[model samples]
Target: MLDLVKLSGQIPGLTQHLHQESKASQERLRRALQVFGRLQQEPQVWQSRHVDWGSHLSFTCASPAEPLENSRPKIEPLKGRHTVVATDGSQIVPNHHEIAYCSLINVGRVVLHYGTQQWPLLDSLPVLLYPSVELQQNSGLDAEEVLALRRAQAEVEELAQLALSVPRRRTTLALVDGSLIPWGLEPLSGQEQRLWLNPLLAALERLRAARIPLVGYISVSRSSETVNYLRLGLCPFLSCECYRYCNSDQAPPCQTFAPLPDRVFWGSLLQPGERSPIWRSGAKVLNPFGEHHIHCCYLNVSEGSVGEAEIARLEFPAWVAADEELLKRALAGVLSQVQKGFGYPVALAEAHHLAVVRGGDRQRFFALIEQELIRAGLRNVAVSPKEAQKRGGIA
Candidate 1:
């Protein structure tokens, strides 16, 4: 009967589909409830390998660089600067006097552009607000985080509108702070994860179709592919060990594949799978407490300040590490360079919300980007924060 009713909406009831839908709710809801119960035995992991303590990329200023006193490789401004959009997002948590209210915070917004970085001013930095309206909010996140995300999105929307309102600069790149795809998209069959990744996946397909050349910066992502391999061992259903099912959704009537595109799945070998090494130029190995070793991706995100004597690059959380001090420093470094470079740096933090580091995996380091501009196929797929050590972008 329900199928009959749905079929009616698809056919003759086209104009009154709403009426048909309302009439069929009870029956459909009943079936959906039964399906949910049947599915309860499924393993539940509140965590998809991606969940972990968020870290920051930090830096301390050295000294300001001398103004370009004379002629020194002054390439003409990026010709017809199309758009080099680099986005980043920071979640503001609610920690107060009495209780650090257990509230999650999120700020998912993207920044817009229309100018060269050499002279980034209010007029140059534009924002893109409403275009993201259809995205599903991760209300699953802490309530405060959801609110913060909405607030931040609203702010950027206003900024984009305002930027469009006035005279503009030659905008080109759109720097999204996070991943090329949204958080929960891949591993599409996972219960909780899908709720997040679905919309993000849609947005990514749209952008990719547009050929926007989007860069997904996963400063501190645990390769979901690797994490799953480590945790569940094989395809949740088949449990095969032959490196198959690389792209199947979690709870599924799954299929198998081999050697999926690097863009489609993160390198599983470096950590568990064959990880990509696009950031080799900026990699650095760290003995954080001077003994226990860790490899990380260090990008000279910005020349916070420079002198012939010293160069300061803001570093941010690139991996899930054990030390709090290290994480704090990294986060501080990335944010510090804003005043010296351009006001848009913080704006750079808004565009990316999900942290999927696929397609030439990279950490957020503007300097690293500058370094890899020449290498063949410089971009990597699912770069690990550990790769920071491999990157030559050492402090």
Candidate 2:
């Protein structure tokens, strides 16, 4: 069915293109490293500088000083009585060829109680979109916006469910697989804030009221918040005027620094069982949260004689970050979980397993929709002709 010979012919050029880009990136990295080292010594000069760089810069670096060492920090072992829960979500976008006029969001959740040896609990929730007349009429919204809303709703619902299900007496730690900050909300308008921000904030508040220690774990992150801080420090002029004179071209002060990711710097500094110092995220979008703003740190979760150590970015709310005991417990719980999954948290892996919607599932779902429509006495409850031809394999 496929031509392997023709596909194989494109490999050489693609390889060459990648090689050239990689070579250029390496050079840029080298230059960035030099600037990073220089800023490390003069931390005070840049520490107090304030810049309103607008929506493009989502986070600020509160602590530019080198990350603290945790060589022998108290790492509490999991009591085995505690509860670990994780949540993940998947979605199906509306397709024009399908008979249905709606989309779907499915959230998968897993709860694991260690030491008891009991089977882990699993659940999947499905939600129908555009169920109301008002919602269906708002067709001006793009696919990205619809998908984002679905994802946000799924996350909030999962968190709310966890709060209600887990008992207050039990020590519970909740893990979300990605950033706590909702994506694409940095430049939020008044309307968007009311529609999106309020719901997420309410969910977060509910979780906090329940006293559950929640953490967002990002594996292999490429965020450069720290690196950008260093860049700001390198600029001699004030934040407002610096951009006018220092453009990021092939020459000048901007070119001296490489576009190194924050992980690269932390990976070199952190040893196994250690975590970098906590840094407050200066994401202006989080300003509305007041005491519940986000903070982050880098953690090295590797064990044994692994060739390359595993590093992850751990993000938590300000309340959790401020408390040393809570932070340590979260780190220990995460480390224990990671050990079981071989560098990943087991709870998250199970949640993702339950959330994924396969191709066969999609086909069956559409078939069921068509059947229901026909049963409702609707005429022509069939897929578009073009879609039918494709499905029938006419070539």
Q: What's the true lDDT of residue 79 in model 2? A: 70
| TM-score to true structure, per model | 0.28, 0.87
lDDT of 1 by residue, 1-395 (tens): 15887676577556578677645643443433333233233323212211221011111101111221112221122233333334334433332221112222233333333334553332222222222222224334544444444443433333333324323433222333433222222222355444443444444343333333223334434332211212231225333332343433453221222212222232211221111222111111221112212222222232232211111112221221233333333323233323323532444543333322323432233234335553545454233455445554665
Q: Rate the local accuracy (lDDT) of all candidates.
A: 0.31, 0.71
Q: State candidate 2's TM-score.
A: 0.87
**In every candidate, how many clashes are there?**
85, 2
How big is the positional error of residue 179 in model 2, measured in Å on the Cα after superposition? Answer: 1.4
Candidate 2 C-alpha lDDT tens digits along 43-119: 55556553344233323444432343335463544676888988888878877788876777778888888767667
Please give the distance, in angstroms, between residue 110's alpha carbon in candidate 2 and its true position after superposition.
0.7
Number of residue pairs clashing in candidate 2, backbone atoms closer than 3 angstroms, sequence gap of 3 or more or interchain: 2
